[model samples]
Target: MNKKIHLKVNTDLNATGEVLSWFEQINQPPLSDKKIWWQCQTLLIEGFANIVEHAHKNLPLETPIELEVLRLNEYIEIRIWSFGQAFDLQQQLQTKPELTDNFQERGRGLKIMDSIAEELNYLPIDAHRHCLFLKIKY
Candidate 1:
């Protein structure tokens, strides 16, 4: 584990920019491959937005959403912690969208996350908390 960057924000959509800004701060020199950097940033924001829209949707407005980003030798690990009921992320990942499907406003998070992350996982951090973990190799 390298130096970790942690942030705790209220479970609201307004905090997205703050999260993205925090992410950009660490991307100082930028990755050698700009595409990789952009992709990882997209995945990170998508993961955070998913939690806000799906996991913490019904929770209190004050509920905390914690984010931890770690840049290792070859990969970046992102952990998003929220106090929401645990869901089967593997099952969700299996439900891919078909190219012919009609246009819909939502239901693409799992697919987007699956397409980008080298490893996507979900775990319970006790009865009251759940974590969404994403790992992307550069």
Candidate 2:
């Protein structure tokens, strides 16, 4: 079975709840498998929080953040669009820069995300916008 969900939300922390609700709508194994479900949810929350805290930090609060989730036969794909300056994701991983989310210790969130996601990528969509992709097997 294949299913997809798309949402466009303001760059506000409040939208995180809505995003989780959106994920629950998928009704797939990712929702039933406790380990996979938790991984997916954690990644979604962390991704959104990262965008709001780092990506869209300087942008207007009203700026839109787009999320597209696709559940395929093998894996689920999540794409997050943020209007932020692009950065070297690979470089950051290699350099081990400090990362903290909502009072969490540095780099903890990122470590979880990196370990959970089967694939993770960030690339520029334009001069000031970028897209983050996270794929997880269900």
TM-score of 2: 0.88
TM-score of every candidate: 0.92, 0.88
Writing each residue's lDDT as its tens digit, candidate 1 over 1-138 gives: 365799999988899989998988657567799999988888888889899998998999899999999988788999999887788988776665642462677777777778889999989999988989999998
**Each prediction's whole-model lDDT (CA):** 0.85, 0.82
Q: Write the per-residue lDDT of candidate 2 for residues 1-138, one digit (tens) a residue.
A: 789999999999988889999888775554667888788888888888888888998988899999999888778888999987788877766666444433546455556678789998887988878988899997
Best by TM-score: 1
Residue range with the least summed lDDT across 10 consecutive positions in model 1: 94-103
What C-alpha lDDT, on a 0 to 100 scale, does residue 57 get in candidate 1? Answer: 85
lDDT of 1: 0.85
Off by over 4 Å in 1: 96-102
Model 1 steric clash pairs: none
